[model samples]
Target chain A: MKTRIFSLAGIAVLLALCIAAPQMLDAYSLGVALQLLSWIALTQSWVTFSGLTGYVSLGHAVFYGLGAYVMALLWQSAPLWEILLGSGFAGALLALVIGYPALRVSGPYFVILTLGLSEFFKYIVIAVEAGLESSGRLIFGAPDPETLYYIMLLLAVVATLLTWGLARSRWGAGLRAIREDETAAETLGVPVTFLKIAAFVISAFIPGVVGAVWVLRTTYFEPMQLFSPTTSFTIVTMAIIGGSDRAPGPIFGAAFIVLLSELLWARAPHVYLVILGVLLVSFVLFVPKGISGQLAWLMRRRRA
Target chain B: MNLKSIALRAATASAAMLLAATAFAVEPVKVGVGIAQTGMFAPAAIPALNAYKMWADDLNASGGLDVAGTKRPVKLIVYDDQSDFTKDAAIYEKLITDDKVDLLLSPYATPAHFAIVGVLERYKFPMMGSTAASVQLKAVKPGNIWFPTSALPDVMGPELVKLMKAQNIKTVAISTLQSPFAQEVEKYLKMALKDSGIKLLSSVEYAPDIRDMTSIVSKMKSEQPDATFSLSFPGDSVLFMKAAREQGLSAPFQFVLVGPSAAFFSKIFGKNLDGIVTMGHWSPYQTKWPKAMPFFEEYSKRYNETPDYLDVALAYMSCEITQAAVAKVGLDHDKLRKEISSATFDTIDGPVKFDGVSNASTPTMFLQNQEGKPQIIWPASDATSTFQKKGPWAN
Candidate 1:
């Protein structure tokens, strides 16, 4: 009861801070914040499925790319809210279609399948754009930066809260059980396949919404920019580095990586990737459980 | 009226002197360049960046840019975009919002330039593009973005065909990387070739990152065209040339787009480069334009190497355009944009007049390699040397 109250209070303060961020910060700082929020939303959505289910997906960028495309295509015809919702539904539908076939295979096969799926979608989008004789879609008149910032912040907060709630639900336990031992969980009538699909679909929906909002803010993008396999790897790496086992792990991880990227981008742009690689390797070797997991362990030790 | 009055007078005089000094000081005009300094685009972008820096330094040395009646020193703030469109957009935004640069210069490559046009439009910042020359950019119709380089692919294509017709080239083979920019080039070339005396024997498109051009080169060789044009990036241009030589395939006329821009090409091919025609915007040897000699001399003296005149000319022209506009409008962005849209300036490339959408229809010069040096060969008046009828490797 006390822990719940503390969590609620913390969330309230975070919400207030996000609400006031645009007014408080300069445009440069606001842009940085938007980037951080984007990473956070992507990492959290990735962890929602991969964290509890113990299934690492390397193709989540497909859903994000699809969402961006959907938004781009519909922005001129449909209302903004409809475009946002349509992107989310499109992502969920794609997740359901691909996840059923993809999840049949486990381990490295699943990872490869996801990675290949993103590449497949990337080429398809390229072909479609080429056939249409269009370079790419451009949003001529976009909303103000502060409005987009608020939308992205709202998405990030909702994704974080949804992940927190899902982690404590009965469905979450079933997913975790399947992660531990799929055969044993199936023998206990856990409906392992159904649970995995559900997690995957829900995980995909958030990134779709975020991607649409991202396109609205950016006002322009091409297939390669949105659907690159490197983006998938980045999402996975952020989640793992933050400690994928906990809800808050990805949040911490995304913040650390995004801030570091911004700082290194300004100073030593060429070596930013090299520095990130070294840090990732170091985190893997020393803190395998991630920062949050390590902190949790420390608290337990003190209690003992 | 005692010692106190004298002390008060001294204080007032000192404060007045400080105010006078503050009033006379000039604030610098800041120019921002967000370009790809690393990754695949760096080979082209770094040279452009260096050219901009050199131009800024030279202007400052001359006591700065002429703004109205006063001279304000020019300062350049540069950032590396890493050749990614998303990152380029964010960095450009920072340049506008954080750095508050007075003038903007376009990034390197078509895709990066296209991505930032919306931002430039949003901020009402006028940008002069040096490297980007895509016909596709005309589709967006953003009034503030200007292209100061040679004519875009659409115009350059007909010019190329005119040259081919003049040389009595009956058959042509073309190969390009399968990118949007390359596609636009192909589209325009094919359009220009329609109904012309010359026939396109083969048009091959290869992936952007394909290392092996043997198959594509072999396909072109099999066609046995009188002339071959390879539209490609610098690295791929080198690879294709090397492959062509190894395959023992030679055409009487070979036109390349990117290879001649780099000195590395001359070093690699040496005398073998003779008779190969390529497109360029400017050359150090050309003395037609008044600014050409001074620019080439100063750049070579400063960098201690022969500069790529195309890159130097583009960078120098952008600065010259900005300086001219600012001088007319005195730092008012709207009035400055209007001034830029309506004015014609004499640059290193000669008279530049922007059209309705701020695209200058500058002429593209065709040059042929002669004894390891590029000499203008086409458009008789601009020709420093006549076109060679046959290459040394011609069968």
Candidate 2:
């Protein structure tokens, strides 16, 4: 009871800070904060499936790219709320369609399949755009930085709360059981396929929404930029580096990586990635469970 | 009382002195540039960055830009966009809102520049596109943005078609990377080719990073066109050329858009580039413009290498135009933009006059590679050498 109250209080304080950030900070800081929120949302979405189920996705950027395109295509005609909701639904439908076939395969095969799916989607979009004879960066008028910051912050908060809530529920237990031993969990009548698909769909929806919001902030989208494989690599790396098993781990990981990259990119643009690689490797070697897991382990040790 | 009186007097006197110093000192004009210093666009963007830095250094050395009556040094605030459009937008936003730069220089390529148009328009910062020359930019038509030394594909197409017609070229094969600029070029070239007594035998658009062009070359070879034209980046241009050479495919006339400007092509192709035609905006060999030779000499002296006209000459001319405008208008963005739009400036690339859409009508030179060097070979007055009608492999 005490821990639950503390967590709620901490969340409330964090929410308050995020709400005040746009007003309190300058445009540069707000921009950075918006990116941080985006990464948090993306990392948490990745964690929803990969964290509990141990199904690492390398092509999650497909949903993001698709969501961005949907928003870009509809921005002029539709209301902003409709665009966001539509993109989320689009992502959920895609996830359901792809997940049914993809969930059947496990391990590296599934990872490769997801990667291939993203590449396939990229080429398909390019071909369609070519067919229409439209081949330039699409720019939608962007919302002000403050409004974008709020939307991104709201998405990040909602994604975190959903992940936190789901992690403690019975669904979470089944997923965890599946991750530990899929055949044993199946023998115990866990409805393994349903749980996996559910997690994948939920994960897919959040990134789609985030991507829609990102398109609003960015105001421009090219197929290559939107569907970049680098985005998928960054998202997965953040989730793993943060501690994939815990709900808060991805948030921690995302914040560290985004802030570090942003800070270093301005001063040392060339070797920033190399520096980040070193840090990621060092963290993995020293604390295999990530920051949240290490902290939890330390607390348990102190209690014992 | 005596001690407090002395301290108060000392503080007041120091404040007065500081105010006097501040009043006399000229504030530096801040110029912001977001270029791809790393990543895929680095090969083109880095040279532009170096050229801009050199321009700033030279201006500061000459007692700065003459703004009104006072001389104000330019302070450049540059950031790497890592060749990502989204990052370019964010960095430009920061440059506008936070750094509060007085002027803006465009990112190196069309896509990156296109990405930040909204931000530039929203902030009403006038930008001079130095390296980008896509016709698609005209569709945006932001009044504040200017392209000084670059010509759109539509403008270049008619000239190229006329040149080809003069050469008695009957059939042509065209290929391009599926980028916005390349697409625009291909579209305009086809339109120009219509009813010009020239047949387009084959046109193919390949994916951006396609390594092998053997199939495309073979198809073009089979068509047996009089001429082959490809609009691609440096790497892809080299790939296509290598593939054509390996397949023993040749046309009476062949033109590539990018590779001839760089030393990389000369090093790789050597004598194979002889008689091949390529398009460029400026060349060191063009001595008609008085500033061309001096600019070339200065750049070579500073950089310890021969400068590509696309990277150095065009970027330097952009800075010169900016300096001239700022000098005339004294840092008022609206007045400076008007001055730039309404006036004709004599740059190192010759006369620059913007069309209704603020797109410059710069001349596009078609040069022929002769003994590992390019010489202007078209547009009779600018031609230093005649166009070669046939290549070594021509049947």
Candidate 3:
């Protein structure tokens, strides 16, 4: 039954994407969707690690930036597949390294540490690596556009699939247990350490890969741009709005925010940021399970 | 968001049918105008786009941009990229494939338009870009596909470099936008000024939200260079001036600010900007075009405000080109491109033509910031304001 639902939903979404792609020959709408796609990938990764496992990441932009840099470096040097694998490995490796020390920390400390780590990357890219000189070495180059777009789309899909796969896995069950009660999970021999490490690493991997794709698409990189606190907040808000732990939460959150951004931003053209912040707060306070989360709960309730 | 596809389909079917009729009837010239009508880069885009519309209306007033004696009304196909390069690319594809516009007026931002330029070049569309700042964008292989309409920093940088050297004030410092457009220009400016025996004390890439650069300014002040250089935009420009003044910091006799957008930098900063040096976009006094007086008069009267240099630079120049092209080429599309490429016309900005590189235009004056207004201080002859020897804010 679960497998059949997955097939049906995936086919529906795929059909929607395929039909929509050709129809969107105009630039205005497609561009918004592309940006939303980037955030969707980012927040879903956040949802996978933080929402499902209850381990919030404040510095997820670090992964995006890392991905951007790696993809930028790989462009023109490697083929498309090689760039993807290389970016994924680089992000996964960075996540694992950070995860070892990071996932062990508790409460707000983990949050602060993650943010600090993200900032460290930001400063390194902007201040130290400004103009692509990092410790007397050139580290990044802008990737070709079509190559970057295809890679980013691929990464978003792969990350989405990974999210679905993890949700039904043993590790996912362990994460749920850990979220409910870390002490009890440990007492139950759920391998809390491995589960946390795995979750953190996977979360980092998605954003990192996405970041690399971003840099490639831009063909330009400045550290402060990819590693900023605003980028992290945007991702977190998307995850929260989407019902962090659900399959479609991040997608819905990203779409909702992207729409608000288009209308408010188009109207004002000066500052939609304050508006976005207010909407996020209101959604959290009143919307309960976010748009997708609420829908999921309602559908279940109707079934009961 | 999902409505984008449906919208695209509707726009294509309707717009193509509308355009095809006029195009078949008398071959009405199709002009492409690209802007960030949607995304993250929309702020700068809205004002910049006013120039395109202003030009369209002005050119259309003369019964449209003329080509030879066969006068055909010009059509403007406006597209909103929603501030995405991917979308910009897609639109360029449609503009080339379906609409088949004769010429393209690009968006305001550097990164988005820069990417769009790559796509346009592929399809061989004649494009005029004004808002991009990347110096590399100017170096495109000599052709009529793209022309840099505004006075780019690459040309202006060298002109300013001459001013900085003449002053003999050695140490220089700078900050630039983290955007690809700025990144490309910053790359060239740094390289061009590298061998000029100037010591750049610090070069920072700061976010647009720098309220007051208390630390960066103070740190620079401690070193005490003869002059300071900045490659920042509007919001940061005000903050830098205020912070530099509040901290009683005077690092440079000149400030080559990139995005002062009109001579309003001085007006915004008040007396604090007296000695501040900057660049000019389009000084009314500098222009010799016939329509300059009327256009300025109309803008001032309608808006109840003075016309600034940046808009005057783009608005007048684009309208001037459209007029010249229409007069030369009648109503044919390909002929319009040829006319635009073949003829060098006098504009409000001065006699200008695309020099093959979509980046470089005829270089304009590098004015010093006197009383916050970038008065033409160089070339001694074009000096509009009496050389206020060391502005009030100058040490």
Candidate 4:
């Protein structure tokens, strides 16, 4: 009970800090904070589905790209809230449509299928844009950085709450059971397919919105870039580095990567990715449970 | 000592002190640029980056960036965009808010350029964009950013059709890469071809990451069109050139959209690259632009190789225009912006005046690879050499 109260207070403090960041930080720091919030939202959403279920999705970019596409298409046509809503809806709808068949596969096959599907969708978008003869679209006069930052913070908070709530629920246990042994979980009447699809759909919603906001942030969209495979790769890398098994893991992951990128990119752009690769490899090998997991372990050891 | 000698000594001492004081008073202008220094875009960006470096070096050698008569040395704060738009935007934000650079130069490609338009708009900081051309540039707000390239797809498309018509080309086959710039060019070229009464034999579009052009080349060979247009970027340009050479796909009026003007293309293709028409306006062989050859020679001497005729020329021209504009109005944002918008600054490509975002004075022109040199071959006025039919593949 004491630990639970402490955790809740810690979360509240973190939320307050996030809320104050735009006002307190310099423009560059605020931009970096915005990036941090974006990654936190993305990684948290990924954790909701991929983390709890141990699905290890590598096609997370599809949702992000599709969301951006919807936002790009309806940019000036719709209100900000409506465009964001439409983007989220587009991502959810895509998840629902693809999730059924995709959830049937497991392990490496599922991973490859997700990766391939995103690539297929990327090309399709490319083809559609080419056919329309509107190669890429640019958004003008997007919401100020402060507005985007606040929205992103809301998303990150919501995603964190969703993951934290879900992880502590009965459904969360059932999802973990499926991860441990899918056949056993299905036989035990866990409603495996339904839960998987639901989680997948839930996970896609925020990333879609993140993508919409990101397109606004960049003020330009090219299908190739929006649907880049590296985005998906980075998401998975962050998840693994931060600990994919729990809600708090992604928060640590996002912070670590965003902060490292900030510190390294300006000073040593060429060697930044190389160092990230090394760290990612080290985390996977040594601290497999990630920073959160390591922290939890240390706390438990001290208590014992 | 005599009174005349003493008086002269005093005058010389004060003059030297005044000169030193004047030099000390002017701070170095912190010019910033975020470019693709690494990743896939790096190969294309190197020439532009080199041009920026060379321009700064040249300016420093000639005293400094002449900021309204008080010559301030340029201190370029360059960041590697890593070929990501978000990173590119962040770099720009850092450059503006943190680095507090006085002037801004453009990032490399069309997408990166478009990415930073919002930042430029928000800061109300004006930038001279090079190595970017799209019809969409017109849609951008006219004050903060200006593109100096004459290679707009809308303009180049009709110009290419006109050039082809001059050669009495009746039929054309087009293979375009599925990139924004390439696709836009293809769309315009098709519209122009339709209007020109030119026959469209076949048109194919390939993905950007395509590894082989064997099938695309084979299909083009079967059509046997009078003209073949490979609307490709540098990578695919090399692929198309190699495949066309190997498959012996010959067309008299062969035009490769981008690559042939790049130095690497001539290096890779050698004598075979001759007579291949490509998109570029400024050429060293054009004696009309006095600064062109000296720039070409100096860049070649410095880099130990020929520069990319298209990108390097555009990059240097942007720097020259920026230098000229800064020289007139110093670093005051409003003054500099007004000066850039209204002024007709001399560039290596000749006099450049902006009517909105596009270059008003420089006509969209094409270059043909003639005997190892990229020579202006179109629009008659800018043509250094008469149009030549592409010869058979050397293979």
Best by TM-score: 4
lDDT of 1 by residue, B266-295 (tens): 667766667778777676566777887787
Counted clashes in each candidate structure? 0, 0, 25, 0
Q: Rank the candidates by TM-score, best first.
A: 4, 2, 1, 3
- Ranking of all predicted structures according to DockQ, beginning with the best and ending with the worst: 4, 2, 1, 3
Q: What is the interface RMSD of candidate 1, in Å?
A: 2.0
Candidate 1: residue pairs that collide: none
Q: Is candidate 1 or candidate 3 better by TM-score?
A: 1
- Residue A41 lDDT (model 1): 89
**How many clashes (backbone atoms < 3 Å, residues ≥3 apart in a chain or on different chains) does model 1 have?**
0
Model 4 per-residue lDDT tens digits across residues A1-304? 9999998899789889888888899888999999988998899999999999999898889999998999899998989999998898889899999999999999999999999999999999999999899979999989999999998988988998899999999989989998999999999999999999999999999989999999999999999999998888888888889998888888899899999988898899889999999999999899999999999999999999
lDDT of model 1, residue B301 = 82
lDDT of 2 by residue, B178-218 (tens): 77667777778889999998999988888876979999999
Better of 2 and 3 by lDDT: 2
TM-score of each: 0.90, 0.92, 0.79, 0.98
Runs in model 4 deviating more than 4 A are: B1-18, B21-25
Task: Give the DockQ-based CAPRI class for model 2.
Answer: acceptable
lDDT of 3 by residue, A115-168 (tens): 999887666665545555321111233444444555556666767777778888
Worst 10 residues of 2 chain A by lDDT: A131-140
TM-score of chain A of 1: 0.96
After the best TM-score superposition of candidate 4, give how far the Cα of residue B156 lies from its true spot, in angstroms. Answer: 1.5
- Reference A-B contact fraction recovered by candidate 1: 0.30
Instruction: Please give the distance, in angstroms, between residue B200's alpha carbon in candidate 2 and its true position after superposition.
Output: 2.1
